[model samples]
Target: MTSININKEKFGQLIHKEKPVLVDFWAPWCGYCRRIGTAYEKISEEYSDILIAGKVNIDEEPQ
Candidate 1:
């Protein structure tokens, strides 16, 4: 699996490139993050052309 760090501007480029992108806006303490993890993984595997399936830790990013 490949990973890259990106912000909103890059995310816009991703959309224009026809890359199927999934952004998981999550924090470590969020219970929903755990629940959605499996679903996100399944999506990544299901789509072959997705360029980005990114996990954004809001806890770490500058606001």
Candidate 2:
């Protein structure tokens, strides 16, 4: 299975439909967030069975 993007509006749908979700809360301007995103993406691909990662931009949405 592949990972999908889940946002605030889709939170309920995702929670009900997918198992073992990994949410990445981040801002575009944050360097650390970018680094972590890269790492997460790599891991997401490597272990597709155990994780489903999605990125969230905190600046544009309500948290």
TM per prediction: 0.63, 0.77
In candidate 1, stretches whose alpha carbon ends up further than 4 angstroms from where it belongs are: 1-16
**Candidate 1: how many backbone clashes?**
0
Report lDDT (CA) for all predictions: 0.69, 0.72
lDDT of 2 by residue, 1-42 (tens): 444566788766666655576788788899998787767888
Writing each residue's lDDT as its tens digit, candidate 1 over 1-63 gives: 534445766666777766767777888898998798788777766664655777667787745
- Model 2 lDDT-worst window of ten: 1-10
Model 1, position 15, has a per-residue lDDT of 71
Pairs in clash, predicted candidate 1: none
